[model samples]
Target chain A: MALPSVSRRLRHPFPFAILAIALSLSTGVASAKLRVVASTPDVADMARQIGGDRVSVVTIANPRQDPHKVPVRPSFATRLHRADALVVQGLGLEHAFIPALIEGARNGNILPGAPGYIDASLYVKPLQVPSSQNRSQGELHPLGNPHFNLDPVQGKRMARAIAEGLERVDPSGADDYREGLERFTTLLDEKIEEWARLAEPLRGVKVVSYHNDLIYLANRYGLLQVGTIEIKPGIQPTPGHLENLLRLMKRENVKIIIREISYDPGVARSLAERTGARVVPLAVMAGGLGPEGYVDSIQANLEALVGAVAESGSP
Target chain B: MSFRFHVGRESRRGGAALALILAAGSPLPVGAADSDATTLHEQLEATQREAERTRDEVAELKRHVADLEAAARSADATPTTTARIAPVNADNPAVSFVVDTALDVSTQSSWQSIGYPDGWNFTLKNGELFISAPIDPFLRGYASINGTSDEGFDVEEAAIITTSLPWGLTLKGGRFFADVGRLPHWHDEALPFVDRPPSIDRMIGGESGSEGLEASWLMPIDLFIEVTGGLYDAVGSENLETLNDNGFFGRRSFQELNFLGRIHGYVDLSDTFNAELGGSWTGIPRDEERSLWALDVTLRHQPGTQSSYQGLDLGAEWMWNSQRFTERDDGGAIMSRIRRRRQGGYAYVEAFFARRFSVGARFDYSESPEGAADRARTASAFVTWKPSEFQRVRFQFDNSWGDQQTNQRFTIQWTAFIGSHSHGFAQR
Candidate 1:
C-alpha cells in the first residue's frame, strides 16, 4: 500500500522529482573523468597522450587486428555506451563496424555531428582519394586511404584533433589537454628529425609494399614505391599479378618488400625469393612495437626499413 | 674591442683612398662618365619595369579577392533558404537487392517441404529488396519487400524504430519479426543452414513475423544485456492455423493478442572467443493459456590472425510449449478437455578450415504439435564456399525419419547480394 502511494505521488509533479534530479547531478559531478572510446589502437594512443590523467581511453579494435574488418564485439558497444567522446581514425577506416557500434551504443553525445564525436581525419589532407568508385577496383575508401595513422607526421595532427575533442567535452581540462598536445608535438618533432636522418640511406631507394598502406611512409622517407603486390586494394594477389609484380620489381631493382605483420607472410616471402629482394615485416598499428606507443612504433619501422636497405647493399 | 675598432677604421681609410684614386682617374676620361650615365639609365629603366609588374600583380590580387568575397557572399545568401529546403534525394534511403536460387531433390514427394517445392525441382526461390534510412534525428525507418516467382511479392518487414529515446530505451512499431528466437529473426538466405531447423519450423510455425510494437532496453551495466518486450496483433499465421485447426491455441475475441518477452546477454570469454545466450517467451493469456518458451546459446572462437581461415562456431536452441486443447464430437457437443506439452531443439557445429570453405552438420528432433505420439528427427550436413563476402554457395544433404514417412533430400543453394547490404552487427 505504501509502494502504491509512493508511485502515485511520482506519477504527478512532486518535490521528490526535484530531489532526484539534484542527487543525480551531484553524483555525476562527483566522479567526472571523461571516457573516450577510440576505433583503433593507434588513435587510442593519441587520445591517451592528449587526455593524460583527465580522461580514460578504451580501444575497440585490437592493435594486431585488421582495421578493415574488426570483429564487432559486445564489449565495444558497452564501452561506447559509456564514452563521453568517440575518437576515430576516420577516412572510412572503421567503416565496417563503427556505424553499428555507434548505433548500438545509443549515446546521443557521440553521434556523427555531436560535440563528442572526434574524427581525427578532419585534420589530415588524405591521400589516394578515388575520383570515382567501382567495385571492380576492389574495396575503396571513398574519402581517401584511411591509413594516415601510419604516417608519423600525421600523428601530431591526430593528437591535436583528439585534444580539441577532449576540450569540447571537458572544458575544465582544456589547459591540461593543450599542454599535453604541446608536449606530444614537440617530442614528435624531434623524433621525426631523428628518423629522417636515420632514413637518409633510404632516399630514392626503390621498394614495394604488399598493399597501399605504406604510401604515406614512402612519401615521408623519400622511398620510391614501384608497385604493390596486390592487383587491387583488398583483393589477394593473383598468380598473374604476382608474375607481373616480379617482373616490375626486377626491372625497378626494388631492394626491399615491406609487408604488414598482420597479413600472411607467405606471398611476400615468395615474391622476395623470386625477385631476390629482402622482405621487411612491419606493423601498421601501435602496440606491436612494445609499450612506448606511437614514437617507438615509428622508430622501429624506420630502423627496419633502413636495416633492410643496408642488408641489400643499397646506397 | 678597441683594437677591433682601430682595425675597422684603418680598413675604412684604405677604402677611402682607393675611392679617391678612382675618382681622380675618372676625371681623365669622358668615356667613363658617359658609361656611368648609361649604367644609371639602365638601373632607372629596370626599376620602372619592376613597378609596372607590381602594379599588374596588385590588380590581379584585388580581382581574386573580390571574386572570393563575391563567392562567399553568394554562398552565405543562398544557403539559408536552400539549406532549409532539402534536396530531392536527401531522404533517399540505402537500398539493396538480394536473390537466392536453389535446386532441391527429395526422395519422398509426400513429405512437407516448408516454403520450397517438393520432388526434383529447380526454383527461383526469392529475391528481396531492402531499404532503410534515418527518418529524423529521433527515428529510423526500415522496410523489406520479398518476391518469389510463384508467390509474386509481399512485404516482409516495415518498421519505424526510435533512435533517441532516453534511458537506454528503443521502441519499434509496425510489421517486423517478433523477438521470439534466433532462427525466426534471420532471413532464409542469411540462415546458417539451407533452411531453418525442423524444431523452429514445427514449434514456432515458421517465421514469426507479425504486426506489433516492441520495446528493447539495453541495461546500463558492465556486461552486455538487453531486455525486450513486444505486443502483436497475432503470432505466426501457420501457428494460428495449426492451433486454430486443432482448436487449441487460438484467440476467440479481437481483444486477445499475443505478448512476448525476451532477454539476451553476451560475454567475451577472451580476446578471440565470445558467447551469447538468449531466452524468449510468447503467449496468449486466457482461462486456458497457451505459451511457448525458448532458450538459445552460441559460442564462437575467432583467432586474431587468419580470421577468415580459422574460426569455430557452436550453437543450439531448445523450445517448449504448453497449451490446452478442446475436442468436439460430431453432434457439436464437447467430448473431452485435453492438455498437451511438447518440446524440440537442434544443435550444430561449423568450422572454417580453409579461407573460403566451411563444413557443418546439425541434428534436429521435434515432437509434432498435431498429436502427442507424432514426432520426427532429422540429420543434415552441409558444405559452403563463399568466394567473397557478397556471394555464397552451399550443398546440403538431409535425412529424416519418424511418425511421418522417412525421406531424404539433396539441395544446392546459391545466394548473392548487390549494393549496400548489411543486417547490422548483431546479425552474427
Candidate 2:
C-alpha cells in the first residue's frame, strides 16, 4: 500500500509540469482580448481591421525601413513572447529576421504548424516563381514574389486569413471575428473597384521601379513594366546597367519611374533627369506613408502612379 | 437509364433491328408476295440508312466524351492554391562552414612566435564548421569546430541552451567563450578589427574560452538588463603566454575553480540611437590571487531608412588586473611575494558610409601583467567590405611601440561562408 501511494505521488508531477508548460505558452487567456503579432505593418493593419475590438495587434518590422533588411530588435521578441497569434507575410519576405525572433520568443503557441501561426500569403497566388536560381543571379525569392499585399484584391484574402487565425486562437470570439471580417471585406471591395476605374490611365503607360517591389501593383492595373533601375532584384545598379536601362527606357518611351520611399532617390532621380520621365515616390507597405491604413496606402501608390503617367502624357 | 448525350443513334438501331426481325420471321401471303417483298425492301433500306446515321451520332458522342475528359484532366493539372513557401529548414540544425585566409607582411621574423606572419606570407588563418538546432522542447544545442593549417581541428564550443524555462532564466552548459568582456565574447570573424586588441590579448589571454556552466537572468524591469554568472574548471587559451603561468588558470581542486560574473544593460536612447553598458568580474579562487575587472560601453546610430547603408559605432573597454608574483634575488634565493596591480584598455570608432563598406580605428595601451617594467601602446586602422552577405574582405594596418619592442604589420584577410549560419540575436 505504501509503494502504491508513493508511485501515485510520483505520477502527479508529470501532469502538473505539462499543465504549467501549457499555461506559459498560451497568451491572453486570462484577459478579455487576444494578442496578435504581425510581421509587417500591412499585415498588422489588416489584422486590426479584421480583429476589430476583439483583439490587439503589434507590428514587428518598421515600415520606413527596407522590408528585406529589418533589424531583429530584442523588444520584438518580448512582444512575441506574450502574443496569442502570429500573422506573417510569408513567401520568404521575412526570412532574415522573423525566424530568429520566433525562436527567441520561446512561445510554442506560434511555432509553425501550430494553430496560432498564420501565413497570409497562403491565400494569394504567387508570382515570379524562378525557373532556376543562385546567389550569383541576385536576390531572387525562390518561393516567388512575396509582395502580394500591394495588390488591392489580395487584401480580401489576407483579411480572411487573419480573421480565421484570430478565431483559431480565441474560439470564444469566432462570431465577432467573422463579423469584423465581413465589414472589412465589404469596404475594401468598394474601394478596390473605385481605384481600378481611376487607374485606367496607367493601363498602357510604360513604367520602371527602383526594385522589383512593384510587380503586384503593376499586374493589378494594366501598367506595362519595361525595366528596373537595379541590375538585379536586390543588387545595386552599376553604371553599365544604368546605361542599358536608359536606352531601353528611351526606346520604349517609359514615362514613369517608380521608387520605393525607403530607397535613396539618387539613382532614380539621375535616371529620370536623363530620360525626361517623372519620378514617383511610392509606399511599399501600409504606414510607410505615416499611419496610412492598408486601403489608403494602396490608393496613395495608385494615385501617384496615375498622376505621373497623366502628367507625362499631356501634350 | 437516361444519358445527357443524344440517343438518335440508339433509336435508329432499335427500328432497324425490329424491321429485320419482322422481315426474317414473317411469311409472305401468296397473293401479295411481290408487293410485300417491295415494301420490305424499302423498309430495309430505310432501316439501313437510320443505322448509318446512328453510328455517326455515336462516333460524335464518343469524341465529345473524350474532349470533356481531356478538359477535366487539364484542369486537374493546374494547381489551384499557391504552394506554401518552405520555411527556412528549422527542424534540422543549421549547419554552416567558413574559411578565413590572409596575406600578411610584418617586421617580425617569426610569424608564429609573434602571432603575426613575417614578410609576404600566405596563411590559412582559420576554418570553422558551425551547427545549431533545437534539441527538444526544453533545450537548444549549438556547436562550433575550428581548424588551422598549423593546428588540426578542435571543438571550439559545444553547448546546450535552455529554451522554455518558467522565468526569464537561461542556462548554458559545456565549453563556451567566457563573458569576461566584450572582446573575449566575440568570435574572430565577427570582430570589427583584424585581431584582438593588445590590451585584451595580454590581460585575458587571446581567446578567453573555457568549459563551464553559465546561468543568466533577464531582470524584470523596463531597462534591458541581464546578469550572468559562470563556473569553469579552467579559463584562457592554451596557446597564449602570460597570466597564471602561460595564460591559463587550471583547477586542481573544486575550490580552485574559476568564476565569472557580468551585468549588461542596454537602452534605446532614441529612434536612431542606442547604447549598451556592462561590467564584468572574473577571478580564480586560489593562493595565487588572480583576478580581473572590466567595464565596457557601446553606442550606435543608424537611421531607419538607411540602416543598411550608413551607421556609426563607438565602443570602449577598460580593465584592471591584480595578481601575485614572486620575485627572485640575484643569489637564487626567494626574495618576496608581492601582488602586482596593472591596468590596460582599448577604444575604437567605426563608420559605415555605404551599404557594403566600413572603416574603423583603434588605440590600445597595456602594462605588463607579470610585474615587469615593460608596457606597450599600439595604433591600428582597418577597412572592411562585404561583397555579399556570405563573403567579406578586409585590410588592416597596425603600428606598435613599447619599451621592449617596436613593430609594424599589414594584413589582408578574406573570408567565405556557405549554408545557413546564424549567431542568433547577437548578430545585429
Error of 2 at A287 (Å): 2.1
State the lDDT of candidate 2 residue by residue for B1-428, as single tens digits: 23324365556556766666577557867767777767667777777776677678678878999999998998788867678566776477778988888887888664232255567878777788999887987888999898887778888879998877755678889887777778777777778887778788777776677788998865443345566788886566552222235444442665456677777766678777878777777766554456787888888886657444688889999889887777779997878888998888899999987767899999988877654366777899999998767788999999877765577899899998776567675445
Error of 1 at B96 (Å): 1.0
Show model 2 residue runs off by greater than 4 Å: A1-33, B1-92, B107-114, B239-251, B325-338
Candidate 1, residues A227-250, lDDT tens digits: the string is 887667766677888999999988
The number of the candidate with the highest TM-score is: 1
* DockQ each: 0.25, 0.16
- Residue A19, model 2: lDDT of 36
Error of 1 at B39 (Å): 12
Chain A TM value for model 2: 0.88
* C-alpha local distance difference test of each model: 0.79, 0.77
Chain A TM-score relative to the true structure, per candidate: 0.88, 0.88
Query: Per-residue lDDT of A127-198 in model 2, one digit per residue for the tens?
Result: 999999877767888999998898989889888888888888889988988998999999998999899899
Q: Worst ten-residue run, lDDT, model 1 chain A?
A: A1-10
Which lDDT value does model 2 have at B272? 72
TM-score of each: 0.83, 0.79
